[model samples]
Target: MNFTDNLAIQLKAAGFSATTDQLSQFTTYYEMLIETNKYLNLTAITDPHEVAVKHFVDSLTALDDKDLIFKEGAKLLDLGTGAGFPGIPLAIMRPDLEIVLSDSL
Candidate 1:
């Protein structure tokens, strides 16, 4: 099974529903990471399973409290967000939340 399929199974098992657009973003995100890693050292997660489990799964785990995360007009700041660990994924999952990814490079 592909990473997207495995991610779906894992999310469902975690009692969350991942839409096709989310899956597509996950796939595209992984693909872009892989492509960019050729020139830059972005993430240590190279394997699909590892990326899904460590990166994606870990990111989605924070969504357990959907109500608190998506409060009306919530502002989140990710400080020193190198590659945006929880920030980017959180943004993707909850577009309603405002996010400011801050980094120094």
Candidate 2:
């Protein structure tokens, strides 16, 4: 299976059911991240499976609660969201949230 399939499996294993569009977005994000990292040194963990588990799945782990920590339509700020960590993933998971990603650079 390809990286996308691996990502979907990992997400499912973590109890996340990402929509097709969300998966597409994540795939796009992953592609861009890898492409950019070639020049910008975005991340050290570049292996596909590692990125899937360590980055994407790990980001969504915070939402395991049945009652989400943030209220609907809440504005969230991902401080120091380097290369869009939990922020981007959270936004993808909860479209109702208004997330702002920030980084020093």
Candidate 3:
């Protein structure tokens, strides 16, 4: 299965739902991350599955508390957001909320 399909499956298993378009965003994000890593040294985890689980899934853990994470117009700030980590994925998952990704480097 492709990255989107695999990500969808994993999201479903985690009690989260992602539409095809949302999954496509994740796929695009993943591709960009990997591509940028070639010169920027963004992330050490390059394997697709590792990125899916370690980066993507781990980031979604913040959504376990829907009350806090999904609050209308909520703003989330991910400090030191290397590779966009939880910020990017959270933004994709909860478009309603505002996410700010900041890094010192």
Q: What lDDT score belongs to each candidate, Candidate 1 first?
A: 0.81, 0.91, 0.88
Best by TM-score: 2
Rank ordering of all candidates by TM-score, starting from the highest: 2, 3, 1
Report the CA-based lDDT of candidate 3 relative to the real structure.
0.88
Which structure is stronger by lDDT: 1 or 2? Answer: 2
Kindly indicate the candidate among 1 and 3 with the higher TM-score: 3
Clashes of 1: 0
lDDT tens string, model 1, 1-105? Answer: 998998888777777787899888888988888898889888888898888778877877767876655575588888987767778877777778898999886
- Worst 10-residue lDDT window, candidate 3: 65-74
RMSD (Cα, Å) for all candidates, in order, is 1.9, 1.3, 1.4
lDDT of 2 by residue, 1-105 (tens): 777899999999999999999998888889988999999988999999999999999999878967768888999899999989999989988899999998999
Off-target runs (Cα >4 Å) in candidate 1 are: 65-69
- Each candidate structure's TM-score, on Cα atoms with residue i matched to residue i, is 0.87, 0.93, 0.92
Provide the lDDT at 71 for model 2.
85
Model 3 ranges off by over 4 Å: 66-69
Return the candidate ranking by lDDT, descending: 2, 3, 1
Q: What is candidate 1's TM-score against the reference?
A: 0.87
Candidate 3 backbone clash number = 0
Evaluation by lDDT, superior candidate among 1 and 3: 3
